[model samples]
Target: MQWKTDGPRSIPQAFPYQGSKRALVGQILSLFPTEQVPLLVEPFAGSAAISVAARMYGRAQDIQISDVNAPLMDLWRMIIDSPDDLLDSYTKMWHEQQQGENSLVEAKAYFMLKRREFNDTKDPAILLYLLARCVKAAVRYGKNGDFNQSADNRRMGARPANMQERIHGASRLMQGAKVTSGSYEDPLVNAPREAIVYMDPPYQGTTDVPDHRYLTGLRRDVFSETLQRAVDNQVSFIVSYDVVREDNKYGEPLADDLGLLHRNVVVGVSSQATLVGRKEMSIESLYISPALVQRLGGQDKIDDLIDVEPKTQDALF
Candidate 1:
């Protein structure tokens, strides 16, 4: 699949997910094999910033994206397979809200209608609108597994023209990719030895709360075992899991028994803390499989790529 060069130079992001790795694309991609690989796989696939970046830079000849959330994965499917249809549906809904006498009231009402429709039908367009307009673009779910986030009345979702460009751009880059909605384990277990599987499962802090951040919460033990299986299979992988903000660590670090190389990547200050009148640096944990670490040289080489001094999980914790 040959994509045209008319797309934006920057990585094209099609979703407004809160924990997206859009900011860390450069650092993450730098850690990938310098030579293009046969495939790049993302199991969590939220926003798929890494996949998008990989495609943009020709880091992989093929890409595979999977997520537990069926509707969310369906949106990615639409974006990759039929971007124009997705764009048209989203644009129509985006413009229809303004047709009413009072735009705000109408927008709220339109949001409610779409939310109901989304819950009932799992339409990708409605989910896209809800995510774009929802508060902080954070996905929240009711106990019954319904889309429960409210609309941000101050503004409409992404402008149609911009959305179209992004949709088309992402579609072009992610062309010929295999996308699926199911267990993250599927992609991990099935990934070829030469493929690099990137896992960004829901952070332990976010998923363990009463208000679930993801549609499903991944158990730590299950995840550990999954990584173990991947390691036993000699699959190269990287994980963006856990973080520490201003000396306050969120979630437990992965078990040390996995023998994965651990490094802390400074991801800049915390916007959430800054909003509440505090300045805090946000540092994220990057866990690399031994095979990947060996392939990328060694601990020192990986450290230099991310521009962070050598540090272990114990120091960060």
Candidate 2:
């Protein structure tokens, strides 16, 4: 299948992420036979970038995005259903915060402060936009879900301009797509048999930068059970995870114990303190039934997915 890139040149500037599958969506789509164009589902939709891009490329007919995080889901809904109101509210909050105004205080403040501290300014819209932009694109939180992280050197571009285009494009393309908030297992348990599940769970392991909260202990067993059910039901699914040592299985061995298809897709080099200078490669394990793999061809199709080039640096305040 032929593939074409769409959207603005500074698209990533608007939608920043870590280990985003946006670049590889094309390769994955290329592997997908034309007949399998629609019914794409992202069970763990962090930012929904992959599915959104898939729709933009005319690859999928419908996308079902689900996540357990309420705030993230709320943000997604606001962007798609009420972008104007959301942007206006965020903009007002941004300007007020910039002027040192403290009248606007609420759950939204968590997002605003995180963005400001991370971006080094008080532009609420830009901050909220950044919070929306990052991979999982989330603000780091503690056990209580309180935002508590300082921004690093990674600077993004103007928030409003890029956000407008992304929101507009995503909102239009996602007309048939549905976004929901719930456990990953819930959607899969209730989804149609023909659905394809793309799982990008939080990296399971220790991190040097202990700020971001990916997936916690809420439903670890449930996640594993869901994968098992997918395999039993002959559903097609792909799961991505961080690299871990054989000695340290972290309770559940990813490929060995989990019974995931043992195809390792090389990702970026790891910079984790424990694995510093260690090649830093990640893998995508396929765990659906063999019949499903045969129906979808094999790893050759998935191996073709590639990443797009990162956007140029710019001032984002």
Candidate 3:
């Protein structure tokens, strides 16, 4: 289906993922180069929401998706290259867990078995099932770098029919896209001049810490240096870093001397703050490279475009 800016809020998502950026795709796509670029690269491509949106909107002719998490990338590769096989495996596992009388207990057991298999053999389908049933669809890895998140137990993952549609939709949109498992550096540093590199790295607060959500922890200093290399190489890029809740910024801002322009796209109310009896708006900082800023009609012109809400959705999803 062709996605219009004013269409429904739900984008075609192969699987549920925490911090997927699916909600922000419209606003993010608005900032992409108006002319269709030859290629679009996503190094830290968790869910690859922006790349899917870019393809659907005809903003990119080719795409590259990479991540440090091999199993996650394997799942993405399956979604892109072999949707039917992946869905068949998921469907079988989804039905297998429904056989027992104690539904919840049986389902939890099924999830645990799949999680173990994913950690042991790194099966893409098992990983997909685990993410679908995991708590908050949040990815959590143990010190041994195994997927350790527990099952939600309340609902079965996406229905077979729904999963089928999402998998097919995402696969169709990303046909022929390159999928890889590697560090963010390869794509970021080697992006062609005609390519637009979109990065959503682990936030400063989450990185360089023990027992964090990500399997691989990134050092801020090292990440900054890599970004500098990209800038020095004249790569056109955009970064989705930390968020600002109310007037409080969550993480340290990127270095100012990197030759980039910064803007905050208001992402609506903070769920965390609202639960504590307070209403605070969350605004995400978007760092645009000098090349991209000029490509979009310089800083002043881009400011006017960024200030307006995306026509696709009335509020954050």
Tally clashes: model 2: 9
Q: Which digits, one per residue and each the tens of the lDDT, describe model 3 over residues 1-317?
A: 11235431456788888877775665677677664789999999988988888888788999999999998899998998889999999999999988899988999998998888889999989988988899988888877898888899999898888899999999999999999999999799889977899999987767455445687888878888998998888889999988765435678888998877887776556656787897665567889988888787888777766654233332433
TM-score of each: 0.91, 0.69, 0.91
Q: What value does the lDDT take at residue 141 in candidate 1?
A: 85
Name the lDDT of candidate 3: 0.82
Candidate 2 on 36-71: residue-level lDDT in tens? 456777877876766777676667788889877655
lDDT of each: 0.82, 0.54, 0.82
Instruction: Record all residue pairs in model 1 with backbone atoms less than 3 Å apart, i.e. clashing.
Output: none
Error of 2 at 293 (Å): 0.4
How does candidate 1 fare on TM-score?
A: 0.91
What is the per-residue lDDT of model 1 for residues 6-33, given as tens digits with 9 covering 90 to 100? 2323778887888888666666777776
Model 1 residue 90 CA deviation in Å? 1.1
RMSD of 3: 3.9
Which ranges in model 2 have alpha carbons more than 4 Å from their true place? 1-15, 31-36, 100-138, 151-157, 206-212, 218-221, 243-259, 266-291, 298-317
For model 1, the superposed segments whose C-alpha errors exceed 4 Å read: 1-9, 309-317
